[model samples]
Target: MTKKKQNIIFLLVVLLFTVVLIFIPTGFENPSLHKNTERVKAVITAVNNSDLQNHGIVTTGTQNLKINILAGMHKGDTISATNVLMGQKRIDKIFAIGDKVLAIVKTDNQKILTARAEDYYRISIEWILLAVFALFLIGFAGITGFKALLSFIFTALTLWKILLPLILKGFSPIVSAFAIIVLCTTVIIILINGFSKKGLVALVGSISGVGITCCLALLFAHFFRIPGTVQDFSETLLYVGYTHLDLPSIFIACIFIAAAGAVMDVAMDISAAQNEIIDHNPSITTKALIRSGFNVAYPVIGTMTTTLLFAYSGSFMFVFMVFMAKGTPLNIIVNTNYVAAEILRTLVGSFGLVLVAPITAIVGGFIYVRNY
Candidate 1:
């Protein structure tokens, strides 16, 4: 079959898969009581905050708001809303008159009992931002950018629809994650480089890196004695009747999944470099092509290894600051479970990046130079 027809078929399959995922139930819908709670777009018509005073501080406090619902069953209805302030800056919001917001109206037997301000209605703005991003991506990279966007959407759906559901349904997290990573790597490489020698080299190298990372993560996580409870919400999952869930294995799986992107990147770099070399010098031997791949990967490996360090450390900057402020000892800070987890994640992921480069180089050598 022609390559053009193959590309068209691949895109159609991806689109169909995306549509199927869209309809797949996540089993996290609201209960029957919440069924009467309608999220509606509302405009604040009035705000009365005269009775809001907390210890002589005029901070965020309760405000009675008159809201006009613009959508849902109670369209064109003006209802009273209570904006409760919890004194937490992140969750609290003070609404001004004429401000548009999302208000949750609770009803019993068709009678509105309470209306609460949930959040600002920002979906339009969010879509505008997304549109700008898509426009810029397509404008810059053209068809490649379009393919990348499709891959991005596909990866997101696969994780949310397939991987998460499987894990929640009691599947082995490590195996599930590995399978998803392999699927993502294959689809993404093919989407970008087509189903050719470059894609094959990249897929093999990426899977190899993921395998090595997974094994190393499992081995080191066991020896480090860091309980899976170190992960946020892991203990909560057990407490909430999911006692059979293997958190450690899930944590190990997360390590490779986190590194998969960088590993795939390194593999693609080596593969693309080898392809370029082969195209330029058709007579290049396997040994010379391998050397060329290695040359291209050297600088990339250095920066990509540090890339994992920066990415992992960025999330823990606040923790690091807290430790420093408390004057914690180096050994204590390093041995802390949270700190140890971050260390393991960065190091093991960097190891994957380091391994994928040479692995890809070797694979690319065999694929690209074999023909010559």
Candidate 2:
């Protein structure tokens, strides 16, 4: 097999091994068991006909359901679930009279199954969407697409199965974020570019970018005195026994991790630009090639810093609107920890974007001159 194919196979093996080793110990297979409640397979019978379901969505407007439960203790039970109109008008799901669905039967402590149609229908839809995306990727990029898909899956599974758990276990949030970032960077870059000078340049550039962002995040986080609780769901986490987790540090870490992708893009762009210059003019001096990288990075910096700014600002549009409506004073708005946190996030990420150019230029210059 060719070098690229070999590298792809090796990455797949490593990804599979990492996932199995990291997730299996977490007992992710078992569903949570709640007191006085057990999940059962149930089918929908009717919609909105009784007080028991006044709060339920009317799927079929009180029509009788024809779907039957297909599994568990209620394998053959037939029930009706309502297709309530959500009235928000944006919701597209409209349940029909004969649609099969899984219904949750709330027993005093154990749930019996009622309907299975909705669950099956949702699963079918999910599969269909997955198939469409897979086909699109395969059609567009072929083997590269396949490798990208694997890398995407591995990154997702790693975050879900390993990183979150580690954070919840009271591990240092910065340490966990860095560790996950390293793992993700390695897998994603190698899967896409293989183990070559180009990949090494991208890795080095991305890491340097992340490190710069992390430091900026820390310094500004302290300067702004933004509390970690500015993050939504952070308090929820603390209530769940992760009180030891430092929210501010985690927030800082997340700034870098979030910017990592953009930084990698900048790195790869410069690296590729430098590579093409070398390939076309193999005798170009290293200094001249480095200047070429700087030229590419300059335009990239302008666009990407704005990209990060808008991305961060978009999330706070509602908050800004609320402050405006309330006629909140500028000082108050600026002093709010939540607003300050976002400011830090934006500036820190922008700093990373700014730093990526120099790092990538240097690394790409060396790689281009040495490799080509």
Candidate 3:
């Protein structure tokens, strides 16, 4: 077969494999009953933000609602459920006082109450915004932007639909995370560069970098004496009967998953730069191509180091400030799980960042340049 046809076949296989992975059963022990209890259509009565007496960011917002219990045993009961907004920092507005919404209802001992936030669809605005941005990107960058958007969607879907489900199903979180890293890297690289030698080189480099990142996260997470419970929402899952879950391994998995995108970005950048050097100077020796990789990797390394640092630091700035205000010692503060996790994340990812240069340089130089 011709090179073009071979590339096409390779992409089809990868796409097919990704699709299959979505249907793979995750063996989660606890299965929730597939049931919707009751429907409560409630209109928000008033919306106001009030300050909590002793809390920093906590606010007391009340949702006064007129509820029509439309389904289940509570059918025809026109009751009012008042929801108090605790200081939980959710992505949505957590029910404004006057925002009309629906609720899931459950009854016990003749008391009918709201069960869940069935009407959390208020955050559809974020989805709408993302859709508009995707369209704008497609319009501006044309085909390249469209491929980028697809890569973006695949990244999000694989994390949510594949990885999360597998983890909840009691699958080995490390293995699942590794599989996701490979799948995401392959999808994104091939999508961006097509199925050429450049894409292959990028795929190898990214995989190697992710391997290094995983090893570092495992070693350091163990060394630092941090527990898996450091990860947010872990305890909550345990309370909900997912206590059999292996959380430390999952925590380790999260480290690389978070770093995978940045590592892939670095690997592709260096590999592409080396490829350009070879194309421009076809006679350029492998040594020169390797040097070109170094040239590209250095700036990328510096920028990415800060990129990871700031990305992590921004989220924890408030916690840092709280510690500082309380006169907590730097050593103790740094040793806290919250602070230590960021340190591990930044350092392990940086190690991968450091290692990608040589991997991409050597791989791109030898593979694309026809050196044995």
Query: Best-fitting candidate, measured by TM-score?
Result: 1
- In candidate 3, what are the lDDT values of residues 191-233, reduced to their tens digit? 7787787888889999999999999998888898777898888
Please provide, for model 2 over 19-109, each residue's C-alpha lDDT reduced to its tens digit, 9 standing for 90 to 100.
6855576543434444434344444444433322333443322323454666655577565444444333344244454555545444443
Give Cα-based local distance difference scores for all models: 0.89, 0.74, 0.76
Which number leads on lDDT? 1
Candidate 1 per-residue lDDT over residues 1-372, each given as its tens digit: 988788778877876887788898887554885787888899999999885766543355688999999998899999999988877766778889989999999998878999998888998789899898888988999998988888888899899988987887799999999999999888888888777888899999999999999999998998887777888889898887889888888888899999999999999888988988889899999999999989999999989999999998898899999999999999999999889999999999999999999999988888877654
Least well predicted 10-residue stretch by lDDT in candidate 3: 45-54
C-alpha root-mean-square deviation, each candidate: 2.5, 5.2, 4.6
lDDT of 2 at 363: 80
Output the lDDT of residue 126, model 2: 75
Ranking by TM-score: 1, 3, 2
Model 2 quality (TM-score): 0.80
Error of 1 at 230 (Å): 2.6
Question: Please, what's the RMSD in Å of model 1?
Answer: 2.5
